[model samples]
Target: MRIYKVGGAVRDRLLGKPVTDIDWVVVGATTEEMLAKGFRPVGADFPVFLHPNSGEEYALARTERKSGRGYGGFTFHASPEVTLEEDLIRRDLTINAMAEDDQQNLTDPYHGQRDLEARLLRHVSPAFAEDPLRVLRVARFAARYAALGFTVAPETLELMRQLSESGELEALTPERSWKEISRALMENQPQVFIEVLRACGALKVLMPEVDALFGVPQPPAHHPEIDTGVHTLSVLQQAALHKQPLTVRWACLLHDLGKGLTPEQEWPQHIAHEFKGLKLIKAVNERFKAPRDCQELAMLVGEYHTHGHRALELKPSTLLELLQSFDVYRRPQRFEEFIAACEMDARGREGLEQRSYPQADYLRGAATAARTIAVQPLLEKGFKGPELGEAIKRERLKALKAYKENA
Candidate 1:
């Protein structure tokens, strides 16, 4: 059996990028042979094993055939007869199809190295169109390597567009699609993922809520970008520029979903879009089965982002209510995430990227001021039960009022 370092490890190494994980492909190896050699079998559908010592994944060189539809509708064949080149060709992209042997020699059966040199994202073979998930995977790769000037090959994009039109995207499970989306959000240029998906019409099938924002108009005075979709992409870019976490980036993307639903008569002024957006956010969360933290933060940013923008104008009680709504005392980190998301929203407009968002500090200080309010003082005044809770609220509200005044 010959083992070779394959896929991302080889690709990233040649690109001068950090290699986080190294996947291995064992050619001419059987499950019995692997098990005899102390390799632990882990793959349920294919012959994937873990090294006895390193515990790293080592999958057998295998080929896949389109069995049905969607991403998971594939039949994999792994045997001593399957060639390494066959395994490589079944990969999603050319850059990911390359491999490195133990002797430090590179395998370029599909010209992956040449495409990498050309700064292009090309499919390994025509079989790429068989898997709908490749469309998302290619978009994600585009997002990850966008800073390196990589562009999708025109032919590859046409394949993605064809896949989009084939209705195969509808067969994707929410969990699988969300896996790609969430990973893409953390990439170097997450907005490029969205743009690439849109270019191939995958966004409309995967995220119709986000797609609807494309041609929707917004007030040019506040959003010089004018298009709600463009503004959302800007916000995602700002989130990445600031190195914000996944929760913040996701909130920024979904924060403006309501704007897309604004009645044409309402035009650029979405007076209560915040409330309207909560429904859209809920739909996305439920559809994607998003994590509780991501869903909760997206919902909060969607429903209260305007309140965040208007922090300086809100009354003391309103500020206290907002803090309590975030449950800052129990979950202070989430509050920071909320503020970061809102700040990205404020600075995402054209020519406003460098603009300061003092509302973040204002609200942060309000939370701090409220946190400093002592419940002991109310207890010392003989307050009990619900009365004590009410008194504590009053004191916190009074403190926030003072804090607002001082600011």
Candidate 2:
């Protein structure tokens, strides 16, 4: 059996990136031979094993045939007869189909090296259309490598569009779709992932709520970009540029879903859109099975992002209520995420990206001032039960009033 380093390990290495994990493909090897050599069997669908010492994944070279629909409907064939070329050809991207030997020699039958040099993300073969997940995967790769100037080849994009048109993209399971989405959100250019998906028509299938935002108009006075969809993308880009956490990024993406539901008569004005967006955010969260933290933050951002922008003008009582609503006393970090998300929203407008967002600091100070109202002090004053809670609220309101006045 000949062992070769394959897939992402080889691809990242050639890009001068730090390779975190290495995958191996064993050519001319059988399951019996692998087991005889102390490799522990791991895969159920195919002959994948864990090397006894290195503990890295090593799979017997295998070829797959499409037997059904979706990504999981493939039947795999593995044996000594499966050539390395056949194994490589099954990969989704040419840049990921190359292999390396122990002596560091390259085995690039698919011209993956040439594609990598050209900064292209091309498909390995037409079989790319068989697995719908590759469409999301390629978009994710575009997000990951966008700063490096890598783009999907036009023919590959056409194949992705075909997959979308074929309805196979809808066949992707929620968990699988979220896996790609969450990873893409954390990439350097997460907005590019959204753009790519939109270009390939996958966005409309996977996230119709988001897709509907494209032509929806917003008040130009508040959003110079006018298009709610463009503003959303800009907000997402700002989140990534600021290195905000995943929860913040996700909140930015869904903050304006309500705008898409505005009545035609209300074209540029979406009164109460903040609260209107709550259900849409919940729907998206339920669809993706998003993390509780992400969903909660998105919901809060959707319901109260405008409140953040109005912080400076809001009554002290309103500021206290906003702080309490966010549970800032116990979950301050999530409140901070809320501020960051709202800042992204305000900054996402055209000609406003570099403008300062004083609302963030205003809310932060209000939170700090409210937090300073000690419960122990209320208890020390012999306030009890409802009276104590009421006293604490009163004290917090007083502190926030003074804080806002000082600002």
Candidate 3:
């Protein structure tokens, strides 16, 4: 059997990047031979093993035939007869199909090195259309390498569009779809992920609520970009530009789903859109089964981002109510994420990206002032049970009132 480093480890190494994960392909190897050599079986669908000492994944060279639909419908064939070239051809991208030997020699039968130098993301073969998940995977790779000037080959994009149009995207499990989405959101250029998905038509199938935002108008006096879809992507870009966490990024992506529901006659005006967006956001949250922290934060931001933008003008009571709605006292970090999402919204407008968002500071100051109200002092004054709770609330409001006046 011959072993060679393959896939991402080889790709990233050529790009002068730090490789964190390594995968190996064992050519001319059988399951019996692997087991005889102390390799532990791991892969359920194929002969993938964990090297006994290095503990890294070493998959037997295998070929696949499409037997059904979605990403899980493939039948794999593995044996000594499966050539390394055959296994490499099944990869999603040419840039990921190269391999490296122990002596650091390269085995690049697919011209992956040439594509790397050209800054291209091309498919390994037409078989790329068989697996629906490759659409998301390619979109994610586009997001990851966007800053490096990589663009998907036009043919690859056409294939992605065909795959999306085939309705295979809808066949994917929610958990699988969300895994790609969350990872793409955390990439250096999260907005590119959205743009690539939209370009390939996958966005419309996987996230129709988001897809409907395109061509929708917003009040141009505030949004020079004019399109709600453009604004949403810009907001997502801002979240990534500043390295905001996934909760903030998720909120930014869906903050304006309600705008898509506005009547055309009401075009530029989306009165009460904030409240209208809550149900759509909840649907998305339920669909993906997003983590509780991500779900709760996205919901709070979607419903109250308007409040965050208008913090300076809100009454002290309104500010206190907003803080309470976010459970600021119990979960201050989530509140901060809400503020960050609001800031992303404000700066996401065209030509307004560099503008300062005082509302963020204003809300943060109000939260700080209200949260510092001490309940122990009220308890010492003999307030009891529900009365003590009411007294604490009153004190928090008083503190916020004072803070507003000072500002």
RMSD of each: 1.1, 1.3, 1.1
| Candidate 1 lDDT, 1-407, residue by residue in tens | 99999999999999998999999999998999999999999899998999999999999999888899788898999999999899999998989998899886999899999999999999989999999988999999999999999999999999999999999999888899899999999998999999999999998988899999998998898889999999999999999999999999989999989888888898888788889888889998998899999999999999999999999999998888899999998899999999999899999999989999999999889999999987787788899999998988988988987898899
Name the regions of candidate 2 deviating beyond 4 angstroms: none
lDDT of 2 by residue, 75-132 (tens): 9999999999999999999999999999989999999999999999999999999999
lDDT of 3 by residue, 1-407 (tens): 99999999999999999999999999998899999999999999998999999999999999999998898999999999999999999999999999999998999999999999999999999999999999999999999999999999999999999999998888888899899999999999988998999999999988889999999999999999999999999999999999999988998999999999999999999999988988999999998888888899888888899898888999989988898898889989989899999999999999999999999889889989998998888889999999998999899989998999999
Candidates 2 and 3, the one with greater lDDT: 2
Q: Which stretches of candidate 3 lie over 4 Å from their true place?
A: none
Angstrom error at residue 14, model 1: 1.1
Error of 3 at 400 (Å): 0.9
Let me know the TM-score candidate 1 reaches against the reference structure: 0.98
Q: Give me candidate 3's TM-score against the actual structure.
A: 0.98
TM-score of each: 0.98, 0.97, 0.98
Candidate 3 yields a Cα-based lDDT of 0.93
Query: What number of clashing residue pairs does each candidate have, in the order they appear?
Result: 0, 0, 0
